[model samples]
Target: MIAFLTSCQEELDLDNPNAFSLEELLQTADGFELLAVGVMDSYQKIPANEFLLIDLRSDDSRANAQNGVYPDVDAYNMDTNNGDAATYWSNNYATIFRANSIIDNRFLAPEEYQYTIGEAYFFRALCHFNLVRAYRNVPYLDKVIDINSNEASNYPQLPPSEVYEKIIQDFRTSIAFLNGGPQNRYRPSEGAAICLLAKAFLSQPNPNYTEAELLLASVIENKESFGYDLLTIDRDDAVNFLFDADPNDPTVNVLTTEEYRANQAITFAKIFGNEFTGEFSSDNLRLDGTFSNNEGLEINEEIIFSIPYEAINTDNVASSQSGLDDQVETDAEGFSNAMTASGPSNGVNVATLDLLSLMTPELQPVRFDGTFRSITVIADDILNDTFNSKYHLLGKPMGTIGLF
Candidate 1:
């Protein structure tokens, strides 16, 4: 019987040579920093860049002019192998697992690195919140995972209601530690946690609106202290950045070497432009590049929390897994960049007529005195007898690549 049982199962050594033990990592300053980096990397990989999955699921977007585009998700076809579902499940779990590893190792961290624990709590809550939103149920993994245990693979999912309790708890833990952090906008801040926790409160089945309101009010009322505010762009720079009065201007057709240099490190370019392209135009918001450079842009007052995705050779921080692979194609890159006028440029998703018209006439939303913030980026679609107005095209890529 023992032989039979032994024969039924295969065993393999599962030691990870590259991994550091909790004790080993906290022994030095560099080790703690490495642990912090692990948390950030895990978060960055969470498939948040896939807008087709998220937007197609909503009425806000549809496939391109091509027929049967992203049809499974567009049609709400939740099949067993739904790519979006699988992506969310796998990515969220990976983030949760990383966060759990950090939480599990918190005791081993030196006092100076205690903020790493807080960051893990926030990431854990964020990942769980994403899963619950997508699936309405998930294996809320608050405990450290044992790779050797069969139960790890066969873990059960919790209903969102129960999972939410854990989410709240995690956020509270995050806020408690992060509230006393260095106040870095790139990482989780006390205000960011409060904002997210408030959002979590609102997302509940029986939403705690009172708490949400209080949390939101605290951020808004003390915006300066909370490290949040709208960016006040110079009038001429804002206009020059986004629009071309004359779309036929040859000089504006492609981004010149000078123009690219000016916008290279700017958030406007990082989010809207593709890397290493002479493809800058006033009408086309590709001045920065297709995959927006999100590194230092995180601290921009306009941003709350951002996932950083840099191109090759653009290491804003000293980390190994910090850049994106090239996804070059004949006309289109591998990913979608919607920060341009759809018909005239290589924008994949265009604003639907339903949305554009709603924003026009009396229904127009407010914009700054001399800014393109609320202006519609319309592209003429002669084939469809309608104009495609791209709405809010900035910051198309990223969802926190940092694992810590």
Candidate 2:
């Protein structure tokens, strides 16, 4: 465990569990790139830790009942403590810690401070943004304070709105430091900072959608220069997107800033964006198993963000179904849904039919399936038709919110 302890003002001695200091590291230009690497680590760690998060809000879970992933989203449920919140919080703070140490140094001994600080600010903002979105409130690291200090100990989680304010401040500061600098393949620069700032402002409650749309558009326009593209797993091409990449190779382009900024296909497809696989069984129909219709579309170019599942390397596939069959028994009294009866990889996280019906009502009409036929429909008929026409749905149920 690294600890930031007493050190000389000339040298910001970083107590890294790893064997190097930021000053010694900055001797090489590559050291400047550590900011980017730290961000990558923070992002990837989200899905790697089993207890981090369960995306109950996933498409698969929201589409069926028996397969409902969480059954409940209440914080104290068995699922809440699974590790999503804790891991995400830990990783984000870890990145912030690194950034704080670097920024605290008064000397601009290295050429990379501008770039590194910008990246650090961006990451700090990014972490806070995600934390707010997932957990609603979290502790804000307001100053450069020791992690071991009593101050750190007594801090309480702040409101989401305040977190957004700090995020905006951080991004603005980062942008100023970067000074409209050109972007790098793997690092945050002026453009990335601007894009993130736009995102942070727009994502907060009561968003300024006008600015958000414009920022998103800019990201779309500069995607290539920013080193992002909607990754297509060409069936004709030999490599699969996830497992084929050497995990340890730091230089690999796993995802790009442009894709992230644009909310492109990859961003929308995030089963768990940073995790290596979508939280689904690789062999189940959603991709390779029973849900062939959706899975076929999922693995194709339309999918913007997905981690591949490799049954061969159990650890490598962040989500898999190797041992679930025995856990859920099927019998006359048991739920006879597709998920439990199928297999471990095939367990269902069913979403209410209402959601699917909202997307495409004609396809799933009343009495379409004996068990699935709508029991009741409530809502103003006129408004329903208007929304249906706008979204291209025939009808929708009242009070419908999807679960993954």
Candidate 3:
């Protein structure tokens, strides 16, 4: 029994070759890359509640009364107990936590992987910026906190003024660390960091217009180096469609011509890079498209950063069946499930009447049609109502405020 116990003790004392500590892993370049991807993944969840939290509270959009917690948000009567607000707050902090993990251990990464740390700083600054804009006073988390440690107490809620200072500092740090152009439009770049820093300067309590101007001027002057350009339609092409005509007449050449419809289709395709079909109608509602497929124009030079989602097929069966005959498939990440008028839970987000009035077809034809669509509902053999579409084409929501 003593010999067996000794042998067991010796085996227990031996180190397992397969085990790798986080600290040891972080010392390599690949670890930093992996952690940077995690920061982006956490950011993906931040946009799920963006329309509910931001746009619904504004005059440009309103929430459907039937959806959960959205009507309260649209009415401006939402309190601390709001579920959407809580989820937004939690998602932002979760992203900050992942970013902090990379930032805190940045020193361990090799020289080539330093840009990943820069990306982390950019994301951390972005989350804090959004939090401060939405909730005003927020905790600025600069480092990863241990549950058993006193680090939680170290970061208390700070005033917007102090939080802006930290945000500016982080953006500057990110700019200093990042180099060259973006690897792709989906990843962070030095130019993006610079542009964000300039915006931060303007967004703070005391605006620094001069500094912001200088930063923006540098970016504009070096725009070609960063592969940035404006996506514009030719003046002649727009002039061919926009003229003084009775837009309601389907027989009118300007409104009903194939040339005009083709131009609108091309404009939509350029902006969204999605498949589209055009039609001429009496009400001047003509364009239809789905934002599911990409036509390579999705990653144009104008885009600084964006989130990409591909259609995923998933089983829709409620219970297991003995054969494949009972299986049904559906798009797991389809925009139709969340934003389309034909969606199961439609009207979750729709344009306010005021916004729709300002974007009439006669006044702003291209802008109006590109931003919104109208769906006519028929009931009892008559047209019941026409509803404005949601901003479904604005893929992967970005942080924006009314003041900005």
Each prediction's TM-score against the native? 0.67, 0.51, 0.75
Index of the highest-lDDT prediction: 3
Q: Candidate 3, overall lDDT? A: 0.65
Candidate 3 TM-score to native: 0.75
Candidate 3, residues 1-404, lDDT tens digits: the string is 99899889967877877865567668654888888888877776676666666666888766566777667878988887877688788889998999999898887878878899899999999899889988899999988887567867665899999999999999999988887635556777788888888889999999999989999898779878877766555535553433435667755445335336445545554454444444444344444443232446655666666654433223641111123231111121232235433342456557677776676656666555454545544322111222333222324323211111
What lDDT does each candidate get? 0.57, 0.44, 0.65
Task: Give the higher-lDDT candidate: 2 or 3.
Answer: 3
| Regions more than 4 Å wrong, model 2 | 1-18, 26-29, 48-54, 57-82, 106-109, 176-192, 220-352, 359-404
What ranges in model 1 sit over 4 Å off?
A: 1-23, 48-50, 65-69, 231-299, 312-348, 365-396, 400-404
What order do candidates take by TM-score, descending?
Answer: 3, 1, 2
The root-mean-square deviation over C-alpha atoms between each candidate and the true structure, in angstroms, is 10.1, 16.4, 7.9
Clashes of 2: 33
